[model samples]
Target: MLAKIEELLEQAKLAIDSATSVEVLYEAKVKFLGKQGSFSHLLKEMGKLTPDDRKTIGKRANEVRDILEGKYAVRENLLKDQELNSQLEAQKIDVTLPGVAPERGVLHPLWRVTKEMCEIFSRLGFSVRTGPHIEKDFYNFDALNIPPDHASRDLQDTFYINDGVDRKPGDFSPWLLRTHTSPVQIRSMLTEKPPLRIVSPGGVYRSDSDMSHAPHFHQVEGLLIDQDVSMADLKGTLGFFAREFFGSEVEVRLRPSYFPFVEPGAELDASCPFCKSKGCGMCKGSGWIELGGCGMVHPLVFKQVEMEYPKWNGFAFGMGVDRMAVVKYGVSHIGLLTENDLRFLGQFRP
Candidate 1:
């Protein structure tokens, strides 16, 4: 039995030394030390021996087990260290390699143009103002001198909230998405006194969409009120804006037009920057490009806001911000500004 135990220990030692991995070493340990193993089988046979012989064999067996356990532990740790080193060598990163760069984002062209226009106006002594996209009928129309029967009040032109279906016969004015930023001017006039110069830039909604128009668009409207404000001041300011925004060489002109909120309104035009006022396809063979509308404030508008008419005269001008972006960036369609295509928008990176 002693010779057999010694032979088994030698076999275990050889198995432990030959094992290439921890899994193989664990299998070797189970083979010798398990319940059905050689060591357990030898102990079972000792039941037939005398008590003194059984005690001596048990002592020898325990010493052998301890020695084998120590050997297995040392071999296991060495194998683990070698495996870790191999993995480290295989997975090491190259310090000389260039790091991957993350993609960057840019401002949308619409917002970029909006900020540029606002900054340009800010330099001209106009502070910025904004109003709610959802507005009351009074501020949008009535206070702006736009009569109830005006063409813009029709369902086809304006987007009325709740479709005006929940209104009673004599309730408050109907709510609607604002048609223009002019409502901001009205609200400003109600709370502020004359000598107010402001530019309102924000989104407006209409019940229309086409190549040139959209259901939702943006506008920048300017209002300047003081004693003795006139059409000449409006033209001069607009001309300076054209020169500064388009180019130092660009010129501005005003043609007779009509708007409800102004006593004398004119369509604002700029000499085609693309052709330097020479005929071109951009200006449709004409030397001018229609920019927007400008006018002297109507007396009826002042009456609605309770401001003395002639004592506090002013001029208001409004232009489509989308149109400005289109002209500035040479975009083919107004609808392109709203379409969230990355391919189209990626071109405007700063």
Candidate 2:
């Protein structure tokens, strides 16, 4: 029995030394120490020995088991260290690399121009006002004295939300994409009294797209109402706006034009900011560039608003914000404003 115990100890020591992984080391432990293993078989045979011999064999067996357990513990720790070393080597990261630079963003050119326009208008005592992109026919047309037979309606090239052709001009369909910000004018008059001076800057829709036009564009409409407002006051205000916006050297002029809401509407122009009245491709070889349209508030327009007709006189004007931006920046195509081309937009960054 002693010889057999010695042989088993040697075998266990060899197995623990040869073990390469924690799983193999655990299997080796089971082989030597389990209930049906060599140590247990030897103990079963010990009951036949004398008491003294039994005690001696028991001490030897305990010593052998302890030594084997210590060996397995060492092997387990060694295997764990090797596994940890392998993982650390595989996941190593370098600390000396330079960082990457992130890209910068900027505002759209259209918005920049819009801000510039609003700033100029604000400086001229015109408070900024806004209205819904959707509008009713009453405020957009009827309240502005623009009737079903108005000629200006033909020129607007409006895009309607409903079947406009199916309804009469004055029929006032439920709603439509506002053709101009001028609807805000009617809204302001309906809600506010005279002595209201404001400029409405917002998006408007039309059924046109070209190098010079976009299906949807921005419009800045100005309105000044008071008991003593005059066309001269309109010219003076626009003259200051043109000079401040274009340059202090630019001149303003009002040419006779017709609009349904104004008894005597006129197209306003400024000396070409690009060529200063000299022929240029930018101004289409014309000495002057038309800025917008303006007129004294017509009696009919006042009456439509139910605002003590003729008791309050004023002037209103509207201009395309896109055209203003193109002229100011010399942009070649109107479509470029909406294309989101980073290279083109980058030029307008502050």
Candidate 3:
């Protein structure tokens, strides 16, 4: 029995050494250690032997089993490593081969327009500023002199957080997602002393949408405050911006418009670049494009900021970057801008 145990151990060692792969090594291990294996069969013969002979045979069997198991474990590890190395060598890479090129990403058209607008103002000595998307109604309406009963307060137009419950309809204290970037002007006034010149560029939310309008969009608002600023300064600044943005020959005009924040506001227009003032589909055959709204800051706005009403004056302007991108890129529908179709977006590369 001792000799037979020694033979089994030697066979297990040889099988383990000769195995070329982890799978073969595992099979050999099971053949030796499994339920019907040589080691198991030897243990089953223990009851047929005398007590003294059984003791000797069992001790020798255990010794051989331990040695075989230790050597099998080592060979299994070796075979696993060898198989991995073979795979690596077979799948070797060519270091000198041309590498695959990765697809490049670009800024969205709205973002590009926003950056251009900001850059235009930046060149005119206006630093960039931003404010919270959710804002107190005072900054959005009341501080800007908007009446509480105005149609703009209607649910169909504006996205009010609550029905002003527990506060009332006229309350402007609770925060809301701002409908426009005009609130940034209030934030700039409160945080900084006068002689401020800044352009705010970011996202704004509204409860309105159409072929040309979206519930969420980008805007760039310009604000400049000083002791002696006037409408002429506003006109000159806008004219320079239009020329720089739309080309040297483009014409700009302002028609009287109204806004709650500005006492004497006007809508700015630029001659259509596509038709060169001769009329086209982009300008709706009018040869001019409405760019944005601008006006002299109302005195009440100054009063809200405690800046001594009438002592300081400024101009504010809000322009839809989405609209500007449409005019610049000849985009027919605003939905095309928000859609994540790579084919449409890829056209605006850089």
Candidate 4:
């Protein structure tokens, strides 16, 4: 038995050393150390030996098993390392090749205009503010002094969201896609204190569409509140914005208008930058492009917001970003801004 054990161990060492791969090493291990192999067979035959012979065979068997295990482990580790190196060599990457160029993307025209407007207002001491695109009825309309039955709330004009449960026509927090960014002003007023100067820019929704109007569009609304704010302050701020944005030579005017949220709302128009205030087809020969609306914050709005009326007088304005982009760049069709045409947007890059 002792002789047989030594012979098997020698065979195992030679097999393990000659193995060139992990699979070959694994086969050698199974043949020598497996349950049905010669080593295990030797253990089963131990009962036939005399005590003295049994002790001698056992000692030799242990010595042979230890040598076989050490050789198997060493060869297994070497073969595994060689296999890993071979795989890595086959998968090596060449860093000298010319890189593939990724298609470049630029900001959308509407976003570009919105960013430019916000940046201009930011330089004028206004911080940007935003609210949920899904707003409550109170903030979007009620808080802005629009009553429930107001023309703006008609289904043909507003985008009201239906609650999953039975609900009233106008619950306390009835959800709807905000019609304008003015609701953000109400939200800011509710949480923030007076002396607020903020510009809200985000996507708005209405039930309208045309060459100049889309069901979805972007707007940037400005709000400024202080102790001594007036219509003149409104004019100066918007006038500066118009000159900086359109051109230093462009003129701005505020004609009498009506908005439920503004005490004396006025339509804001800028002298055509394209025609330089001269008759042009772009401006429909009027020499003026309608910009947006602006006015003193209505007293009812302050009352709804719980801000002391007359004590905190401020002005608010909202401009359509689509229209601004058209006016700024002389876009003939509003739909071009949203058509995902890279050519139209590429013109506005930087």
Better of 1 and 3 by lDDT: 1
Misplaced by over 4 Å in model 4 are: 1-101, 167-173
lDDT of 3 at 343: 94
Would you list the clashing residue pairs of candidate 2? none
Which pairs clash inside model 4? none
Estimated TM-score for each candidate: 0.84, 0.70, 0.72, 0.70
- lDDT score for candidate 1 against the true structure: 0.89
lDDT of each: 0.89, 0.84, 0.87, 0.89
Error of 2 at 242 (Å): 1.7
Q: Candidate 1: which pairs clash? A: none
Candidate 1 positional error at 255, Å: 2.3
- Model 3 residue runs over 4 Å out of place are 1-98, 163-173
Tens-digit lDDT track of model 4 for 101-185: 8877888888888999999999999999999999989999999999987988888888878777676755433788999999999
Better of 1 and 2 by lDDT: 1
- What ranges in model 1 sit over 4 Å off? 1-10, 42-67, 83-97, 100-103, 163-173, 278-281
| Per-residue accuracy of model 3 over 1-350 as CA lDDT, tens digit each | 77878888888888888988888888888899878887898789889999999988988888888888899888888878888899999999999999999999999888889999999899999999999898888888788888778777667767767645586555543567898888888888998998999999999998888776789999999999998898889999999999998899988898999987887999999999999999888988999999999999998889888897567898998889989888888888878999888999999876
**After superposition on all CA atoms, how large is the RMSD of candidate 4?**
8.8
Error of 4 at 289 (Å): 0.9
